[model samples]
Target: DARVTQTPRHKVTEMGQEVTMRCQPILGHNTVFWYRQTMMQGLELLAYFRNRAPLDDSGMPKDRFSAEMPDATLATLKIQPSEPRDSAVYFCASASTTQGGFSPLHFGNGTRLTVT
Candidate 1:
């Protein structure tokens, strides 16, 4: 009955500050996803990995955001010199699927981040 867990459910920081968000994906799940939700992007997929191998992160801002997996149950997202436009809800998800890459993702409550 493992579940995805996220830290710092809410954060407010001035522009140009650093923000670190963390997530713990479900145990035994082989796929993980990072997504950002906003009115503009509309739940853009940021990054995904299976079996600790990165799949894609082209949707994320290459300059400020970075996502990584330190272990099977751990994932992290960091934003350096964040801007006001970067404000959004960041979610982490994991799934246990036999199929290749079409498994539905199970998302955490998400880290609600707001940059001033």
Candidate 2:
């Protein structure tokens, strides 16, 4: 399978732990979307590609989590000192948004993170 999502699909970490998740889109799919699913907020777009360059994750808590695309195929999300409230399933989707709106080709199976 493509690196749309990372494995182990379920992750468990204690509070104040550091968690890192990585994803790689299929070839030619330049855009990536990072979303978090929660009971209260449902699907939340934490970050995504912008202007065909590196993502600007200003919408998220910069100090808590950081997102970036080092190359065309690889993307990474890191959470430092993760809190229990950060528990949720994170999905990474790849699409060709450069040409049009979101048209995802592959989506990550989603990583269920449980912080306690």
Candidate 3:
């Protein structure tokens, strides 16, 4: 079965440290998305890519956060000088388009981050 896989299921870091999250999208899927979930923000789409190319990332903080797809199957999100406020569960999801419509996104288990 197709599935999105994420690594380092949990992370804890001090303020100002660097944090990186990785994802392996389902094979043959052309779209990938990153989301951040928090009590205040609910679930926010931070970025999304189609055909392994970034389409938008306006919801992400450009100064310290970045999202990228290094290849067809791998995606990454990074935060530098991480702050306590950045702590949240980050999710990676992937989808494919069919003649009928777009397939529903398959989400990864998410990486829970904690900043001290």
Candidate 4:
């Protein structure tokens, strides 16, 4: 069975500080996704990749956030000079391509980033 793990379930940082969140995907899954949820934005798809190939990242705030998959089981998201508005829950998900982009995704508990 595959299980995902996220680091620093809660993080409080000063504004303008750099924050890094990490995710460990389930074994054998090739697709990874990053999502952000806020009170105003609700649930938004920040970025998604398949087989480490970026499929789409249009929903991400290109100016401050970046997402990448270093390997099959590892994914990372970094924010530089993070602002107060950037405080939110960041979740990472992984899925297998059983039928070409039609597999169920397993999500981590998420990293709760609070910029102060």
lDDT of 3 at 79: 99
Q: Cα lDDT of model 1 overall?
A: 0.89
Query: What does each candidate score in C-alpha RMSD?
Result: 1.3, 2.2, 1.3, 1.2
**Number of the top-ranking candidate, with TM-score as the measure:** 3
Model 1: per-residue Cα lDDT over 15-102, one tens digit each: 9999999999888888899999998868889998888788898988889988889888788899998999989999999997675554
lDDT of 3 at 50: 91
- Local distance difference test values of all predictions, in order: 0.89, 0.80, 0.94, 0.90
Q: Select the stronger candidate by TM-score from 2 and 4.
A: 4
TM-score list, all predictions: 0.92, 0.85, 0.95, 0.93
Candidate 1 residue pairs in backbone clash: none
In terms of lDDT, the poorest run of 10 residues in model 1 is: 96-105
Query: Model 4: what TM-score?
Result: 0.93
lDDT of 3 by residue, 45-92 (tens): 999999988899999999999998989989999999899999999999
Q: Rank the candidates by TM-score, best first.
A: 3, 4, 1, 2
Give candidate 3's TM-score. 0.95
- Candidate 2, residues 12-78, lDDT tens digits: the string is 9999999988887767787888889998999888888843465656657878998888887778888
For model 3, the superposed segments whose C-alpha errors exceed 4 Å read: 99-101
Position 35, candidate 4: lDDT? 92
